[model samples]
Target chain A: AQTVTQSQPEMSVQEAETVTLSCTYDTSESDYYLFWYKQPPSRQMILVIRQEAYKQQNATENRFSVNFQKAAKSFSLKISDSQLGDAAMYFCAYRSAVRYQGGSEKLVFGKGMKLTVNP
Target chain B: AAGVIQSPRHLIKEKRETATLKCYPIPRHDTVYWYQQGPGQDPQFLISFYEKMQSDKGSIPDRFSAQQFSDYHSELNMSSLELGDSALYFCASTQGWGRANEQFFGPGTRLTVL
Candidate 1:
């Protein structure tokens, strides 16, 4: 079974400072997808960024970027100029490229890293 | 943009009772997935459906059953609920079956089994 690991259980970042949340996964499949999702106090889960395993280039979405190291099986999320709104529980999820059992390409998520923005 | 919708944002139920949760997928979407998130825990995949058919399953309990309707809507029926069943149940939808499609998640229904 594939598993995602997030070593940091809690992290604090100064407002306007930069922060990185680390993630690692165990998978033998060559083709897959990695994603970072943010769950705010409202409990709504929002997609932050995504990276394709086949792509060598890292994925960036405005202030959110990912450092994807395929060989190391590491996918880290970097938030530049972190804002108070960035304070949330962030999750790293893994998705397989192929659909198993007709449509079970569900995401495998890590335990999550709680990010606190200090003003 | 419109997003997935789940009914009964909060539900309180007694142990061994039955509860049903409904999900309305986004227009034109053909796939729906169910997930359970315990307190302070990551969401766990429960099951998935494609075109109103059971496509895959995960750690769903035998007491819980779900199905996707022809209209792309879905429902999770929980019978003989236990206290451990209390959690936030989320419904996500995606277009098509394969490929790296981004899933749109619903606000989720919070179930409190007493």
Candidate 2:
């Protein structure tokens, strides 16, 4: 079973600064995918960025990027030039590349981290 | 292009009553998923449907059931609603059931059981 963990329950960053949300996972599979999702006050889930285990290069989406350390089983999301719109609950998720008999891809998510960007 | 659309943005039902939520996946998408979001918690996977068949079921009770039609529309039915079942239900769609692809989500339907 794959499990994702977000050690930081809450994080805060000033506007125009940077903030990194920590995430770790436990999985025996060598190939998989890691993702960061954001849920704002409206309670809508939005994808932030994704990192493929096979790619050593981290994934970057504008100001959002990921630092994926395969050896340490760590995948952290870094939000540069944070803005007030970045305030939301962020979740780290893991999905195994190996599919089961059902052919369904299930996402294992962490407890989540609440990010607050102060003006 | 339409993303994912969920009906009944908000619903209130009495205990033991049945509630059904609807979802319409984006055109051409082949997979549909249902998730539950509780207060102060991350969304938890409830079930996934592909090719009009149930592919997987999450750690939910037996009272929860889902069905997908030929048009790729899906419905979630809660047989006996409980207070614990009160939460936001989100629907998502993907082009395929691949771990590498990203899933698009809907705004979600909030259900309240009193």
Give the number of the best model, judged by TM-score.
Answer: 1
lDDT of 2 by residue, B65-110 (tens): 8999999999999988999999999999987675467889999999
DockQ of each: 0.73, 0.64
Q: List the residue pairs that clash in candidate 1.
A: none
Candidate 2 DockQ, CA atoms: 0.64
Model 1, A1-119: lDDT tens digits are: 78999999999999999999999999978888999999999999999999989999999999999999999999999999999999999999998887532324989999999999999
> Candidate 1, after superposition: displacement of residue A9 in Å?
0.3
**lDDT tens readout by residue for model 1, B1-114:** 889999989999999999999999999999999999999999999999989999889999999999999899999999999999999999999998886789999999999998
Task: Identify the runs in model 2 with alpha carbons over 4 angstroms from their true place.
Answer: A98-104
Chain A TM value for model 2 = 0.94
Shift in Å, residue B98, candidate 2: 3.0
